[model samples]
Target: MLKIRLKKKCKKLCHAVIAGICISGSLLTTSLLAAELGYPEKEELTFGFIKLTDMAPIAIAYEKGFFEDEGLYVTIEAQANWKVLLDGVIDGRLDGAHMLAGQPIAATIGYGTKAEIITPFSMDLNGNAITVSNEIWAQMKGNIPKQADGKPVHPIKADALKPVVEKYLDAGKPFNMGMVFPVSTHNYELRYWLAAGNIHPGFYAPHKGDTSGKINAQALLSVTPPPQMPATMEAGTIYGYCVGEPWNQQAVFKGIGVPVVTDYEIWKNNPEKVFGITKAFSEKYPNTTIRLTRALIRAAKWLDENDNANRPEAVKILSQSNYVGADREVIANSMTGTFEYEKGDKRAVPDFNVFFRYNATYPYYSDAIWYLTQMRRWGQISEDKPDSWYKDVAAKVYRPDIYMAAAQSLVADKLLLKSDFADLVDEDGYREPQKHFIDNIVYDGTAPNDYINKFKIGLKAGDKL
Candidate 1:
């Protein structure tokens, strides 16, 4: 009896061990699949953003539960200014933030602050405009030609404003203008417009310790926060300013200024803000990085899906006090596919705030190169660099590899169609040559040196301050 009982117990133990092994194998395969789908290593995240309509993606992701769908609990906070937002990301207080397209490139190249910040997402395109105070607008109106309907010709050029700037110079009054930041798209676009009309915006000489970009300026450009633009112009502190919406729209609503030219007119579909994070953050939390990017991509698609049918709802969310905090009417003026240049001059600018269409979310290396070219043009680089150097910096800062991985995962999950990302599958990370500047200067990003030399005003090869 004892022998028979012991034999029965051993048989039962053997069967139990076999069952355990089979379950372990099944779990191991499941874990591998989960890894392939990019399970988030860190779920709780805090992101920062400035109060601008271009920050709609971050807002939409949180409001729409896209982040929650990816197992990410996200908190979106508004920073006081761009500098604070950038510092929060650099110091790890915030995981990432909506950053000026130039911030990561400038930071990586040791322009303002030295940090290895990288962006896998370009937030939006063509959401900025140059606004001049009412007084200045009245001075420039006579120079601008009228259309058949008595409206000023669309894309009122800087040529109309040039004579006014010359008058300021002749009278020994400094013609001051406001850009949100030094390394901002507003600065470069404002400068490009001014230079195209034969007005010298100025140059920066950081090598000579003169970082004030007013070396030989015809119109002096200075920094002013976005929210303060209208008030500053109202106070007569600045004659004109270039900034992202709804600030420009706010100016029109308040009757303080008139938006002269949109950045879309300056350079059609130019890359704007980017979602930026530190390299260390990305390396330490690789899965989280891709997951967050995936969430943003989904949000961008939703924003632009159905020909922007969702934009009215998006504008309402952005108008909340916790987000952009502007009035709904003010925000909608630009967010809803139409921009009110003058208070009553509402025009259908359907592409004013592009989120996902035209591959606006892709972090193309050529976009990085374009910002670098502008940096060199304005004397921030203070030296000429080889085309290879431009390419190298672009590769370091714009991580399309991460972008593609996220895109592929989304397609696999059926959240995004493969056809939705057709340009992505075989992308070389460079945009085809762009030719839509207000001055009609064709930009070929592959030849940075040659493109820099083509500029009429700006440092070319072998030129330095």
Candidate 2:
């Protein structure tokens, strides 16, 4: 009786399997189907981010279903500060992070936390500005040439700000400035702006236990958290600050300060943030790494598609407490491509917050090299290095090969096209020497030392301030 029952059950299962296989023809390849299915290696993943508008890629990826389409279950968490966020990535608490472009380079070089962090995607470009308090703005307006509308003509050079700084100095008051972090783009951009105007933003002599960056400085620079920038300025602590939006725009809303110059004017379309992961994480889960990049790329395209028509919606989403937590109007001030200089003086500056267009998401070795060059230029490197050293360091930190693989996968999937990015056929990863700086200095990533030498101010090869 038992054998008869077993035979009957086996025959029934066999018949069902045969019918199912017949329903789906032999031409269907299960392996190819699985690849197209795009399931993530790890479904549940947490990504860490600092509270800034440039972190929009991560948020967009989650909200726009890009991550879901790729089978990535993601959670975006706001970190208290950069150090904590970087530490979270290093310790495996975060699978990856929204990071400063310099974070990977600084980490690989053993600047702050020694770990091999890699960036496959650049987040956005040109969303930062240098803002000054109301009193300082009053002083600076006298030095600047006014427009027909009584507003200062833009691309406001630090030259226009120098006189205000001097008056504070002559009054025996130290002019303090706030930046996000030591390895932050805000710090380098601020230093670049001030040095361009002949105002020394100072250097980091770590060998002498003087990381204070106030060494031989006309402006005393310090690290203030991003959200605290407006309040710090309002409290009369920092006279001015350089930071990513919407903090700069927050000052304009509060009527506390005027945003003097944008980083877009300081250096055109400068690389800002990057999506970073530990070398260990990438090596341990290579497929997961590529999958995440694909999701982010798609999200970036969605954000910038239709000429940023979606930004107002993005601003609303980011205004939620879980993300940036700033008000909608404040976030939109910069996110929507116009910035408020003085209260009710909003001007059209469409490139203020760039997400995807113009190859903004491609991690360039040249961008990494530029930050490294600035580090050496400002004594953060604390020693001399050859040009090859810069290239090697950039290669190790910025993984353009990984980026191309992800981009190609998107192209193959019909989600994106080749024309959306730079002509990568003969691409050598280095941008042609950029000459749009406020100081009019031409920067060739190929010749970092020569660029350093051109600067009248700043540390040169084999020299320390």
Candidate 3:
């Protein structure tokens, strides 16, 4: 009887162990599913950005506690340049970054440092300008029409700078201009404005290793880091440049240059920077991606709400050395709904820097297509592609579906109202053909080939260098 009792006790112990194993398996499955559906696999994230006004989304997200609300611990760091920012995101030193709209698109297409980079959030719209040195400004003043107040009329066009460029050319000097990066929106916008005014901003023949963008050119364009723009112009390296604020405002404050035209005049409310990450990162951390996007969306809204009453505070925050590091007054000059043209000619021009309203944060496919077309026009693409190719590329680079997933999660959590975003259920991720360019060229994302063919100044269908 004792032997039989001991054997029964051993059997009961084995049964308990098996039951525990079964229960643990079920719990593990449930946790994995929960993790896959929507919980940040990694909560602590670092995002990279340049020290410019367009990096506001990343800064605002951290300052407003939006990331913390979404259960994400986020740190924003300033990168030295565009390439460094992209490299940081790719190597995982940064989870993501504030990027040019073209960076992800170009990277995906194997343009530079090939990678499948993607953006779910676009950062802001139209915070760039074409500023010229004080001497150049003096020359341009004679060409510009003066207003009743004895100051130059606002929305100063590239026309005023045309004669100045001509004078430099006639004098056998290189008419130098600065843009932030090769794949930057600033580059294309500056080129567009100059080309529209009948100036050859030059072409890039990357096929021949002439990527300096000075082929058949009237003005020679070069890269100048944004923070160094004012000093560079003062040193007479570049006569004028197109850059984002508050660097342009810095030029005004330092008395080195005067801003002649704003990007708003180049293309009204044009898409600027975007929050970029690798496609692999988004796929690996889907939940984290959505949560991060939601935090950014909230931060963007806070920036433009109430006709920008929050801008002064934002300027102060951004002025800290750890952030943009520009002077508060210099940053506030443009951040507070007023822009200075000449040194003392400050004027109210609201909507100069839009962070959220008008769906600025959404990564629309049309926005991607615009940059792609610019690439093609400038010879970075190197070959002709069909309209469908442009569309497919736009779809790959701009992931509005990912953006909507984040928006929906925010709405479900009651952190945001359903009315706060574009109608995601019906959003086709394309803007109607835009016609507000200074050249008055109509751009339709669906017919990219046709748009390319319409340009008289750029490479057209079946054209090769």
Error of 1 at 241 (Å): 0.4
Give candidate 3's TM-score.
Answer: 0.91
User: Candidate 1 on 1-465: residue-level lDDT in tens?
Assistant: 000011111112112222221222342122332457656678678898888999999988887878866657677778888899899899998899999999999999999899999999999999999999999999999998999998899888999999999999999999999999999999999999999998999999999999899999999999999999999999999999999999999999999999989999999999999999999999999989988899899999999999999999999998988888899999999988898987799999999999999999999999999999999999999998999999999999999999998998888878899988997888999999999999998999899999999888999999988
For model 3, state the Cα shift of residue 430 in Å: 1.1
Candidate 3 per-residue C-alpha lDDT over 1-465 given as tens digits, one digit per residue, 9 for 90 to 100:
000011111112112222221232342122333343456677678888888987887777887777755556666777888898898898999889989888999999988789999999999999999999989988889888888888887667778888999999999999999999999998998888888877888788777877888877897889988998888899999999989999999988888898888988888889999999889999888888888898899888889988898898899988987778899999999988988888888888798999988788899999999999999998888899988898899999999998888787777666678888745568788888888888789888888888888876877877777
Against the true structure, candidate 1 has what lDDT? 0.89
TM-score of each: 0.93, 0.92, 0.91
Clashes of 2: 0
Mark the regions of model 2 whose C-alpha exceeds 4 Å error after superposition.
1-39
Model 3 segments beyond 4 Å from truth? 1-37, 422-424
Query: Which of candidates 1 and 2 is the stronger one according to TM-score?
Result: 1
Model 2's lDDT to the true fold? 0.84
The residue ranges of model 1 lying beyond 4 angstroms of the native Cα positions read: 1-34
Number of colliding residue pairs in each model = 0, 0, 0
